[model samples]
Target: MRCVLIISKMQEMSNVLLIIQASLMGVSLTLFFALVLSSLQKTDTTKSYEIVRWLLAFAMLLFAVHYIMQMVFGFRAQGDDVGAVINILFYSPIAYILSYSILRIGCGNNYYRKFRIMSITGTVLISCTFVGGYLYYGSMHMKGALYIMGLLYFFSIVLFIIYPMKEIRRIRKMVDEESGQEPVLFNMYMRTCTKLLWISALCIAFSIFYTPLLVIIGPFFFIALVFYIVCFLALGYNIRQMSNIIVAETEDEVNADGVEAGTVAVKVVMSEERKEMTKALIEGWIKNQGYASSEINSTLLATRLNIPKRQLVQYLREVEGKTFRIWLSDLRLEEAKRLIIEHPEYSTETVAESCGFSRSLLQVKFKEATGFTTNEWRDNHARKS
Candidate 1:
């Protein structure tokens, strides 16, 4: 009876929840491993692709190492407090990656250097707390230290998640301002990774209770489930979604101008002469009334100018802190005024149509530009003429 009791006391595969949780973790590892390998096989040919690869590796490293430790130690880790310090260690870098790497996927150049500073500092603080907590909780058996450590770690994770979001909004603003290439797919997939990161953060927070088992049954393998979904989607992106994010830069070129609009830009990489060339092309395009087409956008205009759209966009932005659409509006407004002054007999619809402005749009834009309604401006100009 004593021997049987000893055997029964051992941590065994007796719990159905544990088995199912472990199986899900195994599935998570498989999918995550596949994601890492896919990132490797896809080649680091694009900035966005490379950033995605780094994010995958960051998550995989944490998940893989923690999972291995959990499997080997099982419930024993929980008993001995083996997981107290290391869980924070693993979480620190994963939070860093979640905070910065995914955001860098499209807007690497726009990434703030200060994000590096803040995340690194957060990592260091988490480390300090882990060390302090382990000594007090593990060495002194003061359980309060463990709670303090978990609380601090949870706050840090939340900070990391929220910090870079505003900059992401700026990225979309840049897109809407400078390029006609709608970032519809980029926004969607980006939202996907963001939601996953949030879920990962929450999972890590809850796992403070069972740190050693986090990668296994911790939080019921929620992180693993997230990984499964991401890898599944990532597989699709690797195959085709990559191109879908942000409309194709150009019809005839693979990221023509060596820039991905609203994402990868070649501003600093471009030379002065190259910039001047783009400027000249745009000035010539505008001089020829290319802005007179309501359907005209930066991408189409760049193609018509026979120059790279990215180059054209950068120039337009510098032309007065104006976006591509705004600049187009200004140009069209100018044309609308000229038509009114030169041909007063032309009706509002005629002038609006000639200048690529819908009649109502012309009225609105003209009012904004000259503080006068289109008809009002026309009457004033016609009276003076």
Candidate 2:
């Protein structure tokens, strides 16, 4: 009698868990549509954003399908041959979608193309194995199909771990080569993606070994899905913020007097006079206008100079042996040091603002450029004066 009661209670709990999972899956699908709509509404969507949105949409669709399959076929009933086949069909694609999405975000276009080709080839090969195994061994040996699929799924997870590490290294290299500052939001997004992949892989592994365990730990899976949903929301928000920044910077460039001076046509062979004139114009713009603003970036500076951003970057690299970011930081840091030494009455905040740096950035750049904290540098300069 006690055993019967325990079994009944377990069954009740399992049903409740499935209901919660279904509800969360519905919420996730709704969020995916919201993201798609948001992306469509954006006036300046980049190729990268488009790819990310499609990948996310496909992933969510797969999840919704999987949820419907569970509800219709009943969870973890090995006796149902059709349900098992449906699981095999839909389950593998989720990993592939996620893996490809991460690869696209983390890698360059050429690298992404190469990895995607490899992924498709692997998928084809796995599908062949599933079909051949099912035909030859029949339903009695469907375990073989499951085993092969599990191995492929595990391989995808390995990629999820490896590629993100490579991506992190690439981002770090970019920071070192161009700017000395990390892109905080981008890094956070990458980390969240990596974490979600890990959790998904673990859940898949658990489900493979002990299907009943999913019923017991279903709430944990739902929690991970919630995290996944939050991560996408954060990504969308970040994309919007980046777009707004670009728009505002462009407007500022347009509003500046003599904006046409910066829009010089790219020339294959610049005459000596034109070269000198262009150089003078760029210098005057930076000194007169750029140095007074804290929100300047390569794009904004290029627009103000009337040159392509790439041309400006190339020119800085060729002539100054510095990236635009480095060159700009040097200009700001030099002015900041001057303010610190010459105007002792100016507060740190005042100096930072005058030098076109935010207070936090001012502290970081001050230490990096001078090998002393802002306060230490100020105190040392005061003593020397």
Candidate 3:
């Protein structure tokens, strides 16, 4: 009676395991579809995202295959050859996804290259174990292989933590300096990735526990399912947010182009008869109505030029590729430059004052515009002349 009870219990466990594996296989397929959709939404500028999407797709396919093999033949125990295949298939994608997303979220190609190497190395190692399990031990070496995989997964998690910490600090510093009003997509990515890292740490802890709970590891599988579903949904949300931001920015550019078209209309109407009149009007304004650096304003320029404020602003942007202040600053800096060179008797301070900027403001603006100190600019230009 004792032996019969043990055998019956083993059969029940087998059935339960098979059912769980089947359900997970379906989840993998569903996730694969979600990943494809996410990939499709990627902007043209995100070239690295394409590679990650494809890697995820391949990993999911491998997982599906591993599951089909199990359903067709059997997965009786942890030591089964099919078990190794399933374990590797299950872990590799999650590992690769974490690594790839870390790269996508923060670092550049050098970090990405390292992640790819680790991924490929993990794949090669798992592949060797799969072949070795099937050919040699039949199913016994699978647990040892999983412990090795756990080590690899731990390695990846460490890399994920170490590599992104610097970037996270950099972004935090940038956001703090810039007052945190960054684009929404960037902000969302930061929030999602920080959550992912914490969740990943938890997943690693679970994996370490999984090695000990070899027989009754049912809860871990459920936890893993929930974790992956959450991770992918978070990723999908970020992708959609980024795509929307890019599309919105693109539309803003298009609308700006339309505004430029109207500005051109004004130019064409004026071109017919007021060509010389417009020239004289501008020259007279520049000479007499001299826009003091402190007093220059879009409204003031529009009033003096008999143009609409919006039209003046648009015209300055379209023709000069600068806002009102930038164009005005360049004009002042040019005047300062000419005065300093042409009138050696005038001190740089006097020239700056004559050019419509306070002496201190002149130094600050000049350095900002030219990436050099006032004295450096004078010396450099003197050398050039």
Candidate 4:
């Protein structure tokens, strides 16, 4: 009787967890759609954002359907087969859309038609095979069908892995062509997307074996649900960041010439003489005053130089082989070193403030750039003097 009560209680808890998971997913989906809609309305040239928004919306919808089906018919003997089939059908499409979205975002918009056809063909093939096999062999003898579906699923995972590699290669080529440099943010973004893809592939592989375990142990579903929700949230955040980057790039192009008109003169590339002059001016300003201000940033520096921030960023990348942040950090580190060595009386807090670095950040950057703490540098220099 006690065991029966415990079992009932466990089942109740499982249902509650499942409902919470579903609600979270639904809310996240709605919020993501709302954000995408807002971006679409506000931005005129968000092709990449549009593709990502729709793909994510579709993926979220499929997830909702899968969860609903699992909740409704997952435990029933007569309905379990149908539920499993529906889940399987939804899984491949969701995976394919997400993989394709990542690819599109990473690779740019060159081969849309080819990718569209491939996506449609793959979806049709997988769906038809699963449905046809179920009808012919029935659920009891559907191992061959499942195997075929699994093989196709694995193929999609392969594409997911392959596309990211292609994206990395594309980025490398771009860096090579554009002055042998890439922005730090660009590199970080690519690495993050690659990591997300690898994780998604692993999750999909785990799900295939996880479903059976879920029947014997209901709590496992809760763990899986949490994992899936967290993954989706992380992916959604990445998509949002990507959308912002696209919007910024579009704005940069539109405002490159300091003209607000819909059409403007083509921007002439900055010549070597001009590049050297700009670099010298920027360096002089930083050395004299900019590094001491805590509020200094790319925009502020650009304003000082009377150039668009994007142009400044490009100049820094092409001429200096560093991002604005890296350039700023180098200046700050130089100032910090001087302060610690030549003016050892100033407290670390004062040095950090005067050098435009926060207290914790000073510690980190000082150690990273000089291989010594602030005090260590000061003591070493004091001994030398």
lDDT scores for all predictions?
A: 0.62, 0.64, 0.57, 0.62
Best by lDDT: 2
The per-prediction tally of clashing pairs is: 0, 4, 1, 0
Query: Candidate 3 lDDT, tens digit per residue, 207-250?
Result: 43343343345444444544544554455446422321111223
Task: Please give, for residues 1-385, the per-residue lDDT of candidate 4 as tens digits.
Answer: 9999988976775666466546645664664566456554555434675667667766766666666665665432223344345545776677677666666655555534555676667678888888799789966346677667667766766765675566556544433332211234444544555565566455544455344443433334334434433443344444433321222233244346454546565666768987887888787886687767765666666778887866787788788788766777877888888777778899999999888778888888889888999998888888888
- Model 3: colliding residue pairs: 79-139
Q: How much RMSD separates candidate 2 from the native structure?
A: 8.9
TM-score of each: 0.55, 0.67, 0.48, 0.54
Per residue, candidate 1 scores C-alpha lDDT tens digits across 3-103 of: 88866754353344346446645765765677667666666356665665657565755666665665665532354344545566676676676566555
Q: How much is 295 displaced in model 1, in angstroms? A: 13
Candidate 4: stretches off by over 4 Å: 1-84, 96-121, 131-147, 161-203, 206-272, 291-326, 341-345
Estimate the overall C-alpha local distance difference test score of candidate 1. 0.62
Model 1 reaches what TM-score against the true structure?
0.55
Off by over 4 Å in 3: 37-45, 76-85, 108-110, 129-150, 160-179, 182-385
Candidate 2 off by > 4 Å? 1-17, 40-43, 79-88, 180-182, 215-225, 240-334, 345-350, 353-356, 367-380
Record all residue pairs in model 4 with backbone atoms less than 3 Å apart, i.e. clashing: none
Task: Please rank every candidate by lDDT, starting with the best.
Answer: 2, 1, 4, 3
Q: Give one digit per residue, the lDDT tens place, for model 2 in 1-385.
A: 9999988977776577568658857976886787677775664645775777688787788878787767765654433343444555665676667666665554433345445666676667668777877787875347667677657656755665566566546544544444433355655766675676567566654464554565555456556655665565556556533321232223243335242455655445444665676688688986684675765666666677887766676667667778767887888888888887788788889988887777888888888878998889888878887
